[model samples]
Target: MTSTRSVAACVLSTGMAALLWATGLASPASAVQAVIVVGTPSATCANPQHPTIQDGVDAADAGDTIRVCPGTYNEAVNVTKSLVFRGAQAGVDARSGRTNPARESVVQPPGASTGFTVASGVSNVTIDGFTIQDSEADGINTLSAGSGFTISNNIVTGNRIGINFRSPGTTSTDSRIRRNRIVDNNNSLPAGGSGVFLGGGQGTDNLSITQNRFGGHVNADVNTQGVLGGGDPAEALTIASNTSVDSATFLVLINANNPRVQSNRISKGPAEPSGSAMLVDANTDGAQILGNQITGGQGTGIRVAALFGPDPSTNMRVTRNTIRSRTDGVLVEALDSGTFSSNIVENSTANGIQVDPAVAPVTPLLFSSNISRFNAVWDARDQTSGGGTAGTANTWRGNVCPKDSPDGICR
Candidate 1:
């Protein structure tokens, strides 16, 4: 149980100790401590040592390192205070001059649920390098918003919800969910099993879901929808450089505000009855959908519209994206304001760009500087209401179509 295995970080030095000590790692008052967990160690893994991971966490101080050796910790670790639960190969080797990868230790719950939960009121906690699986609920549930969490380099699979960021009533939480392999969280029952779910009612500030693999045997890879509660909308959510494939519903379903959905590879696979590669719903205040490569098979490749919602989809900039779809390449409807420009839309059977404002008097949109081709239907269409009277003042400027037959409000 005490055999050395490859892991995440390294021991802090003199300068580093001072910084982390103020941050509560290693100081004269808050000494840097290590609690080791072996399968069958002589001394019980308590504050300084314990046999179980949870025991070490419960006994340790606010700033301690529970260095678990390579063994299947058959229990859920509930982290209350700010601590680091790393594996044997968690840190770097200063003597060897090589960075060792984090321990691929297994953390399957023995009796309770969830692998590692950063409990409420706990900030600056890190859950790195563990194989967390088979939970009745979420794998790692950051129970509420307004807390800080850094979850990196872990394999989270076979749970009802992978990483559930439940934020209620517009609280601001800072989180970084990067470099994790979140997969195969299958829940046939309704309202479960999303790879990364950002629940409604609250706002997540300084959120970064970047460079993660979110696909394979999941319902929705990433689903983000927050309500317009008393607090302000989520500011600066960055979902970039992730690869999502074979998702049953919505590779990236974003109904949040001011999100930067850039440089993601999304494929709307599995062919569910109702789904899309991407969806930006009516509640979007301002969004930048740029530089993405979306391959569609069943539903719309990129849909920016609302259905019977009061909120206006305004100030969106959808540019530099390559959308290929069986349905509309870029569907915009029921909006008050937006701009779609410099995009390459290709369709095999549907329209490349379909602008249909189902609202009264037609919420005006600008379709400009785009290229549409190879669509069976119209290359660029505007099926707004009332022939021309209702769909007035909507501008279609400098667009290039192969057939040269532009429809509705194209001047």
Candidate 2:
């Protein structure tokens, strides 16, 4: 009889290329790249040749497809070439009760190793639809000098970090991490970890993290840090439309430039010192925080500070957000040249919106058209040295509040 691999290749050469192209497994430019299957043969993946995912990856050329069947893989898969690794149920939500052992591809890394590591200089790699867990380190880690990576639709939990992008010298750009369930990935606490970490020595550009669910993290759900000593900033990073709960911090942007965080639903941040719903700190600039729903956090709903250095958080636009917290709804420290406008802040144990005087001379901030009420402290309190005055420094205009620090601040 003829061999299975040869028969599969012959079948792929005929009309299977069109099917692969239609399913986004292969592009038109690489239409003839073979599809290597791992695990037992099934209706979707016929002629299964490799017993392990690493074997399939080792046999596949660049731009080939590795289709993993429903099974548990207990090994570290390292990818050096640009290829598409598709699990059995790619793009299906694992939280929807649709994931059964008969159709789930799970990767549990043995010992302290990571589930998957996209090596340096490997670009255009896609890893989709797999439950990767129980790793002491990151579940999925991408090294320096890579771009165009798409990691989507998987359950990543019980690891030190869910997904990590570490670019040391060169910059990684144009990566999309969407539609995944990342939970409880803070197995290493106190030492530091996050659900998704974009930090090594350098920062990424045009990185998009959206439409994900995150919870139970020791550190922030999504955390990004720029170069250590400040060389180049993480530019054009977008964190939008995600739901995060019960994390130490929901989102943190440090040394980032022009980051847009919008339309996220965050709730129940921990009562720790780092448990803010959002923190825009350090040398971050040009941040757009808009249209988020924050509820019931013991910590501040939103905090803009410059705690690390003398470079104040500047040019931030915080607008149209609904915030209800046990602490201050919005707190500003060492912030300069920002607009806090059109937000509804209520039911806070402390001030609804406060500008701390500890960072004195918080100048050139515009507070306009906001509704703040039902707070224990003053609804709007600007305690900077020259604040709470009409023409002093910080401008509070057209605000609807019950009470304010200065008599003339509420309208």
Candidate 3:
């Protein structure tokens, strides 16, 4: 009753050079170092990367360590080198997005995106504790200059794109896509969608997207379009503590730079249909919005748009976020400079900050200590910085809204 490929070819012809001399990937005059095994572990590791777990990471090397066991293996794994795959339980990396009705071990069809594809000059890799499911595009795809990596405690699900760090030709730098969990990834087709898409081909810089848990049952769009137009200049990004629900377009920063979106937790699920939840479009520049918390979106939670496509620049520093639902919690249109502070607008049907059309007198916009409440309509609206007039110059300092009457507008 030995079969599990005959006890992995009898432990790859006797401990494969003592497990490649205890995991250094063997250099002892090379015996063609080959030993691929999976499941039913008799405990072993050495030149392993392909007894099927995506062909032992295409025949591993570069300090290999592909040691898996505990059943369920369906394919799609492509780490180029500098490996360290280990998933025998954390989610059972065979794409388990759940599907019963006799689909027992359901090979593929939950979010469908496959897994692992860290190509381009691969660097120190390390994918741990698996549960990647139905990936037709992105379970993990950090292409181009694969730098020091470490995707942890995996559980990525049904995909169009989950973890994508691109830079195929020129610039790809310091990486550390962290603590994984990304679920029901943007699976609405259209090139797979986007759960964590960071395009390549433009010097991708020091990225450190942390503590992941993007969108519950995400129908489409979690985090993509964060600079994927040109080449070189999408620097120092650091999105933290993630969590989104029913995201159709949670975060989109075209032509991005110096970002730091923090403490995320977008909402919209209970069977979503309302779109646009956080779209900082246009040639977005130097950002630093903090303490994010957007909630119950039917549409438009926080939208700051401009640039239309061909490279433009500005400066931003939005602070202390907390926007609420029903639509338009924050929509500061077009830009030149920014510095909103201590934000916390609630119950918006529209207009919390709907200031569009500005390109004159250089009055770029600068509000302070914002805090509008229970909005049913205009708390602050400017079709064009007061020419179209809903609120002009927009100072409204040290704000608050008991329903507005101390000139903070809105009644």
Candidate 4:
């Protein structure tokens, strides 16, 4: 897919300079330009007589902000310029029904339908401090290929998808998805929707999913589910340091290659119900699963599998994470080569590490320096690796049993 320049990308270049200017740290222009505010029927707007969020965005160059007021604005906001769209106060619902025009008439046109539509490939655009809900497709849909954008400090609920990065074929990289409280985005689909979805088929790379609370159920079909999307296989992605609770299927499904899922706290359906915490399926390789604590899911904590029959995983690392519950801690199968080291697997009803023989004809699947103690089942089961020889090739060195490990209290 040939990448296109998104409005978000264009603005991000100038947004950094604007940030510097806003901080009073640098003087890009001769004189400091006063902060501009937009939106109508208010005395505080830059042009109290004539102000619209779109107008402010249109007036802004690269480094600028379009301050949106508090209220229900039933309008689709599109940004072609690079800028920050900030709310003066929190709980600004931009879904439907304008605020009482007499007291606080929120901006709602005669037939405004959607909440926010960020197109024109504007990069580095930060939409903050609002309660955006009940949009047509997504509350905030960034279809443009832009980087360095932060959709933070907002309460996005009752929508199809909280934040949708529809940038498919753009070189939109280095974006941050953080600090947003996303919940109940199960409006459109019956099985519920993802709290946040990053990247479409247009090739997004170097994205970060950090420090956000993603809740609500996502149904699994042949495709589509989980917090992050089945991203473009060509890009390098990162899903780290986030909390995923009560998700139906995989917390984060990675069809993309070279993605890292680290340090995230994930809890899913109860053990009796059976839900896979993370499912890495189909043509994925070079992934790193490190330092994540996953619990209560029915299936494996981390499942790495090929969508096809013949291909194999290579040069991957699953290290130093904590997995608890009835699920297997680290399940490695069908990989040509990889390392599973220093992970603490406990309380699992199944084997600590399940290396499936169904995938690859057993060679050595490295299992070293791991702590598999207190698990309700065997520390390590060689059933799936190979009958006997295929199991021994796995180096089970420096593994402390439940009775002897530092945390010596076995279940």
Candidate 5:
């Protein structure tokens, strides 16, 4: 298995040419990029140029590198240039029961401000390896319309929102957020904050958020909303291989286009009854929810519904997910033209897999190769116009379950 740091390095290298082009630099060979050092002088970062991180950033060129030494920087760092900001132990996760206080770089911003602010129109910036906490706002806030940012290997906690991409329009494109520990950002719970919030915009395109550990968020671990004033949909947004625990909601995708959510471990939803482990709704089309391990709390394990509007979810492919819940395992409402296959749902207090009849049409939906059992009510229940598998408009085949509503649907 490849390490996350190696993978991030490879991904960063792939975008090097684009970064050079975006900065209007001739080439890596031609550009005279300098390296500025911050904090006290050391063996690795000798002859420190700037005493503070913001001073180093302000003095550097667009493509320069800023190396910060191990120290606590109690100030907000505003990044307006496309530079690489590397801290001590950059691209390394030191939260695996290792306490290296002498080798850690920490940033704690005061008042209602962010720790790191990647200003609007600044692209190709890399922020790696820092413990950013105790901010009234986000730990890292990327303003609208920036692209090609690589944020990795940081521990962001005790903020309102850990990492926020506040795109209003002309969305941020081709950014990567990976290998970070984003936890306990529930300080602004009354205002509904999240670990990572992708705000409303033209919707962020080609944004890859993967391999992060998230916990104790008030709203959700990962939350995305589509175009605010209605423009293009968010395309190719991938959320994969994340472990999210003890959040109000694990993942929530609203109106995303063809999003791929794969190989995530989601556990312990909020204590509230309305919380869900995963929710893909609000006319989100072509969503692929695959190969996830989910353990629910008081709410459903997986829910697909247009709770905010009347538009139904369409063309969703939910496959090979294992879910165990205190409430319903899977509850789908206001969906159309989807396939639910090869799922293992069990030990639910309510129905294992239920398609609600009260909402919009769930027709042309295929339920096949599923194993649902040990639910308190019916294992599989589709309360559509038809009574059973033979009469319903939806197709059901090769489902192994103990009990089903309107019978003859389970084999």
Candidate 6:
């Protein structure tokens, strides 16, 4: 067995330098240092660390701790010190996001980009529990600039761009890209595989992407997002409890500033013309789409668009979601205002909750206790007198549409 993991990494390299001096990454004058085992012998550490986890991160020092262990590892790392590269017992039960699969820790890296380059003055780094599969590009990359990063519990699959916090023109603050799994990333086009592509060039601050699990890919917008925000706004962004299946176009695509998409779990697999599964296109001054459970989509399951213009999306809150869609399951057109409550729109091919027909002094859309059934037509639609947004004024109370065709709009 590869010489019993190289004699269990030379007897765990003398007990990993006394467990790296009781997990403090030992540096108190090296406290009798002597590690660097690499493949088998349970990997190992110490002696400024090595045995390839990038040569113990080029001989770790800045608060060292390069554990690694189990097996596979092809090489493509760059990470510039400031360490904490685990994998040995990974996650240790941090919600069992993996690890202990025979001491896991893979990192394939066959041709090129191959994972881990975390550039630009690498700050407070911490990449835990590895798997990071077939990557031709992006699997934990930060092109330029860095900040306190804590990318946790990993698995990240076939990549093209699975976690690319593209720090193009600077700005990458307090990061915490949490609990990961990220499936079939960018299966090569359909927005080219983005399961977390914070593209906002000069953006991001206090970012916290929670419990992740983005979908499998073969094309459902081809994993266009599981979290693909970045066009500047993000100031204390927090996308909660993530989970997606077929993922098409979005499972959270932000233009943050008061962003907080809570209790996530968007179903939808076997791809399709899947477009919406939450796309807060231009959140300005207001945001919060709570308690999610959106179903399949072709258009809206939560698409509040304004196309990133003069802060178009003003005052928002689409609550208690359960949305299912073919089109409008909550499609608040061109912003201007928001407030839809206790939602539960089912089988909609059209309008389950749509307040479109823009242009006007329109800023008072408040539909309450929502509940639209088998929608085919108007379970709730305020196309504001349809004639080109004439003085749009929508205010429906206690909604429950599709009873009498178009009688007083789902009362």
RMSD of each: 7.0, 5.3, 15.1, 9.2, 7.7, 16.3
- C-alpha lDDT of all candidate models, in order: 0.67, 0.81, 0.62, 0.61, 0.81, 0.66
Over the stretch 1-411, how does candidate 1's per-residue lDDT look in tens digits?
A: 332223435666888887887888654643445444544442322223467777777777776766776556778888888887775434321112222233346777753377887777677677776667777777887764435677777777788878877533334456788877787776434556688877645656677888887776445777765344424566668889887777755444344678888998877543644456777775677788889887766677777666424575677888898987657687765666777888998864678877664633234566778888888887877656443322444667788876433343333
Shift in Å, residue 213, candidate 5: 0.5
Deviation (Å) of 398 in candidate 6? 30
What is the C-alpha lDDT profile of model 6 across 1-411, one tens digit per residue? 011111223334778889988898876543223233355553243222244688767765575666777777888888886677777545742334464455577887766465787767777788887877777776777646677778788877788767776432225457787777777776456444666776535555577778877776543311212223345555666778877777665544445567677888877743454677776665454787888887875777887765644456667888898877657788766676778888898887877777666623246667777888887877776666432222336666667776423356556
Model 5 regions lying over 4 Å from their true place: 1-29, 42-45, 166-173, 226-230, 269-274, 386-390
Across 1-411, the per-residue lDDT of candidate 2 in tens digits comes to 111332223346757888788888984543457678888666755667888899988888898888898888999999989999999888786544544666778899998899999987888899899889989888999855588889998888999888987543335447888889898997766544588988666777768889999888878888874244446678878899999878878887888788999999988843544478898887888899999999886788899887665688778899999998658899988777889999999999889998887654445788899999999988998776563464346888899998887677779
lDDT of 4 by residue, 375-411 (tens): 6666665444333233443445566655421122122
Candidate 5 residue lDDT tens string, 1-411: 111111122234647867777989744444467777788777755767788999888888798888889988999999989999898979796335326656778898987889999887888889988888888888998855678889899888899888887433334447888999888887655654588888746677778889999888868888875343324567778999999888778888887779999999988854643578898777688999999998867778889988765677789999999998758998988787789999999999889999888644555788999999999998999887654366665788999988987587789
Global CA lDDT computed for model 4: 0.61
- lDDT (tens digit, per residue) of candidate 3 on 1-411: 211221223234557878877899866453233324444333333333244665565555566566665445666666677777766543333223423322121123223445677766787787777666676766777766666677766767676676776643234446665566676665656566566777654545667767766664443444536455644556777777777667665677666676778888777853576666766655667788788888876777777765446444457777889888657787775666667778888888866666665533244466677887777877665554442123465455666655542244332
Sorting all predicted structures by lDDT, with the top scorer first, yields 2, 5, 1, 6, 3, 4
Question: Which candidate gets the maximum lDDT versus the true structure?
Answer: 2
Better of 2 and 6 by TM-score: 2
Clashing pairs in 5: none
- Measured against the true structure, the TM-scores of the candidates, in listed sequence, are 0.80, 0.88, 0.38, 0.73, 0.88, 0.37
Prediction 6 global C-alpha lDDT: 0.66
Q: Between candidates 1 and 2, name the one with more favorable TM-score.
A: 2
Candidate with best TM-score:
2
Which candidate would rank higher by TM-score, 3 or 5?
5
